[model samples]
Target: ENGEFKPAYNDTIKDYNTILEMFDRILNPDPMSYTSPELKSVFSKFKDLFEKHYEEQKELENSYQVQSNTSTQAIKAKLS
Candidate 1:
């Protein structure tokens, strides 16, 4: 957003924390002009973090489905 400065924060909570934590250093960056190699490397890790979230979401969905099926089967057996 900052003329290709590429702030990793934007609108994401994950990225927000990334930027917020380093706000002091970035807000008054040196005029050499500016760059933090460490920040870039850490931001690149977003992909893996999101991937882990996706896997957990899938696991939660599958477990709910299994519980629903079990409950349905139990009800049907009572009617039989």
Candidate 2:
């Protein structure tokens, strides 16, 4: 299975977690489960990509939240 990712059987976005949780699962899958070097390598590579994406998404969300909260606070102050 060179360059092929194993599909998560019957899984959907509804099962997904926030960015940090995703990163945690990637870097910490059950070590006893993988018996081949190739598979392990692939897992590592995939995890790296996932972790990067997670970090980027988390940053974006945080930034958006900060802006939204600031705007809300400003609006509240003006209203009062």
Candidate 3:
């Protein structure tokens, strides 16, 4: 087994929430009031980054699940 610890689904949720909270704080006092083009651009970039990381996290979780299932199946096959 690898000595590294992969992030779990809960961990990703916490991370995503933290990101949102940070952005909320940044735009606090009137988040909807930010209508400037530059602020919109920044917001768009943040959204893109969030989406990219979410996709990557989803893939990692899926791969981890597949690996776990395969290992279980292999063990069962051997015991058969």
Q: Write the per-residue lDDT of candidate 2 for residues 43-63, one digit (tens) a residue.
A: 778777876887899899999
Q: Which parts of model 1 are misplaced by more than 4 Å?
A: 1-40
Per-residue lDDT of model 1, residues 1-80, tens digit only: 55678754565555444644565355345566464767655554654575578779989999999999999999999999
Location of the lowest summed lDDT over 10 successive residues in candidate 1: 19-28
lDDT of each candidate versus the true structure: 0.66, 0.70, 0.73
Q: Poorest 10 consecutive residues of model 2 by lDDT?
A: 14-23
- Candidate 3, residues 1-80, lDDT tens digits: the string is 38977633335446666767656654452655545667766876887788798999999999999999999999999999
- Whichever of 2 and 3 has more TM-score, that candidate is 3
- The Cα error of candidate 3 at residue 69, in Å, is 0.4
Descending-lDDT candidate ranking: 3, 2, 1
**Candidate 1 TM-score, C-alpha based:** 0.48
Best by lDDT: 3
lDDT of 2 at 64: 100
RMSD of candidates 1 onward, in order? 8.6, 7.0, 12.3
TM-score of each: 0.48, 0.54, 0.57
Clashes of each: 0, 0, 0
